[model samples]
Target: MTPPAGYTKAKPGEVFRLKRSLYGLKQASRQWNKELYALLHSLKFKQSTQDYSLYTRTQDGEFLVVLVYVDDILVTGTSTSQIAAVKLALDEAFTIKDLGDLTYFLGIEVHRNDKGIFLSQRKYIKDILVDAGMEECFVAPAPLSTGLKLSPEVGDLLDSTPDVYRRLVGRLLYLGITRPDLSYSVQHLSQFMHSPRVPHLKAALHVLKYLKGTLDTGLWYSATSDLKVTAYSDADWSSCQFTNRSLSSYAVFIGSNLVSWKTKKQQSVSKSSAEAKYRSMSATTSELVWIQGLLADLQIPVSLPITLYCDNTSAEHLPENPMFHEKTKHLKRDMHYILEQVAAGFIQTAHVSTANQLADILTKSLNSSHHHVLFAKLGLISKVQLEGGI
Candidate 1:
């Protein structure tokens, strides 16, 4: 620790004393993390290099996974007796609360059954709707209306209570963690957070209405999943009216279960649609490589040459061959990382029709009918519908 500005002269052997632990202390979280890591290490758990909070261990064909958040611990494994033994050891070491199964964690509700696990933030969504006074609003088929174009400069300033719009948009962003269907809508509304406009607020209201209709919608992770890894890559060129930057989106799956998805604006502008698509492929490939390594750490074998599907053939060709149009040449020079992964047989590029692109949902808003089709294909479904409760 460094001394205060005026008290820089500290003897090498001098000791600093501390009082009782307090909430706002500078080292509170760090101290907690270090202590927990040391204790887990003593238990023979190896910390993950990718995520420090994650710990894993294996013994006699049984695997255990542990994740720490501050003082809370989430523990799971293949062997029931092993998990029980871990809990007993922790109870002996420290005063602990064992929240039996993970029915809910971090505001995301978990529903499990013979089918699989269903993740949703329904209570969180309802709170937002109530705050916006749209709890009774009419339902919409999709979060964003077709052909709805929003810009920072289009509409007049929100007359009163602009902060309401800002607050709602922020909450919606957090909700997207479990609701990928809301990704495009929330990302669009976030653009005008600095100075929201009337048009933007109206669009945000549309999203709330969509959520009302799809209150039970969420991601479904099946227990019968296979280890086959495949990913879909997509890009919407020049989708943003304010910045003209392309939107990149991809959905990665392990068999029929969706494991990862992303919706973000590209940092650099692309000259052609193929350029935008190829750049998106690079990002998706990076995520796929990371997932492969993590699975390997768990002793799970991923099949060789994971397949990547793209809607554009030109974008697909960039990875298959070295020579191409001006767009491909520029991308190759700047993004040789993705090209090398392909050249070494780490990934195999393939073409899929645009309608079959699961990533399309994250990149742009389609009409109500098209949106519903893609929504289900992305492994998102309403819990009520599955249970015959809707």
Candidate 2:
């Protein structure tokens, strides 16, 4: 094939040397990224380690976050003039298209209001629901039933014609960006994707039905909330019937806005509530330390002694006290790691009543009332209220 414009012609039986990277080449992405990163660095932008794609430059007390995805870049900052200057710099370096204020990126819809930025995958969810043939299905209050327990033995084998099960689960995984309520249930059903049974398919369909009702639901980042880092950690002992493993879950917030969270079944069984809770706290503490470092790099200063709330008081005490008893000795290693952070003033553990434990939603299924309360704490409000006032 003849070489196109901005390309060198190849000699007989020889490949054309690429002057600039293009898609589908082995090292094209890396080479293009190196060039972009070098240009940003020369413009006094510092790359973030927590998220390497995030680059920032602060001048005259204004902050700009330059998010790069291959050749596409999203620049968010305090001033339009500053953003324009950065765009000028990029234009001078390479061919670029400037897409004004981010409305869509990575499948999530961005909506801004006086309240703050609300992110949702409504269009993506609708598309998936239609693709799965569940667009008209009725919605349920929750993603999974509280009393339902799924096991490999519950249902018949799925059809052997094509791999419909794996494809469905993969699409649901992408839906998790705005629907954290589906995290645990999605992760559970994902285990059987290789050989999904009738029961697993039913459960997965139930999740789709729930999504049908809450298609417009998403995360709201409050503009008025203070930028203070606080986290809630909780665990459910022996929740997994298959492996008898405990589940650890944590939710981190900047004031009232939920920024990050996780739900994962533990590798090993915990004999006591304290052990389970300690493991959960350790996981949250590590995330807290990493977030602190990232914030430091962004020059966003935070107050000392970041607070971590735990529903188990025994676990909270275990970290601050060194007395190693029989019941606590088994968790000595996990205890010590979290305690080191406590002593270093990076994080401090505190006791929270289980009723007020927001992380409970992530660890186990909750009733409607409890779920509503936890969702409120996570900065999720009804779309009607979000649009009308609030």
Candidate 3:
């Protein structure tokens, strides 16, 4: 340790007194990350360029991967002995407790079988229900009601006693990790977090009701599924009644496994539905590029020209079209980005019917029957259905 800036006559071997700890400083996380990176580097592990939390190493055709989140670490690879050795070294340094196989991490529960792996949050859902005091609430066929209109000022403001609306919505946001079906509903309700109305509260409770029926539902990764990457992009033009901003939504899949999905409102208003869809396609393309880099870091090969499906024919042709019309002047940059990817053989755009667009669930509220159809196509399955081989 060095002496204070004003003290220039310090002893050669003198050290500053310990008044605080590295963990007590505001830069604790950054300091810890540097130390962890040094240790992993000493072990011949290279950090991922796509995701800083991920580390990987390969020796003698055996691969080892380490995923770190703060102090919690998830290690996996092709060799059990290699994993064990890595764990042994980590435990020696940090005094870690070996939890064996990953059955539960964060709030997600992992169930494994001969078929594949199923990730769920049944317990987390139940806890949310209890916290919301909706344990016995009636179930709804879908998370959000069809043709529902929710805005900032709809009804009387909610009581400020306990802030039930904000709390429930926050938990639902976390629950959305395993329940993509709640993406649209949760994102819609979250818009009113600052000043929630009675109608907004009721709508949030409706989402809880939907959760009651799908408590056991979660993502399933099939063992036999291929590694091909596919994506569905869709948008609801001027969906917000007040702001007139469109919603951009997309779903990404690896073979039959649903890996990522999102529903977000556009920052600026789009002039036409085609523009909205094009914006959604741009967001989806960015996600696909990140996924490609991540897979490369993991030593996984993905087929070139990843397929991107959009329901709008106009948006489909925008990527390959050579000319930009007068109405599309504002979208010139986006057009160039997509056109570059298309020209480089990184993405192939195609048109799909509205009925078959899986991302429709993330854009707007739909009827019960249609919502259920898209839900099933998302590779979501309940534990009972999985056990029965349904």
Worst 10 residues of 3 by lDDT: 16-25
Cand. 2 TM to true fold:
0.92
Find the candidate with the highest lDDT and give its number. 3
lDDT of 3 by residue, 15-94 (tens): 86655347777878887788788888999999999999999999879999999999899999999999999999888887
Q: So what's the TM-score on candidate 1?
A: 0.91
> Where is model 1 poorest over a 10-residue stretch in terms of lDDT?
326-335
List TM-scores for all candidates, in order: 0.91, 0.92, 0.94
Estimate the overall C-alpha local distance difference test score of candidate 2: 0.83
Model 2 lDDT per residue over 107-186, tens place:
98888888788888889888888888997898888888885678877678887722677778888898888777777788
Per-prediction RMSD in angstroms?
Answer: 4.6, 2.8, 4.1
lDDT of 1 by residue, 261-358 (tens): 89999998888898899889999998998898788767789997889999999888777676656545667653587778888888899999998998
lDDT for 233 in candidate 3 is 98
Of 1 and 3, the candidate ahead on TM-score is 3
- Badly placed stretches (over 4 Å) of model 1 are 1-16, 19-21, 324-327, 333-335
Clash number for every model? 0, 0, 0
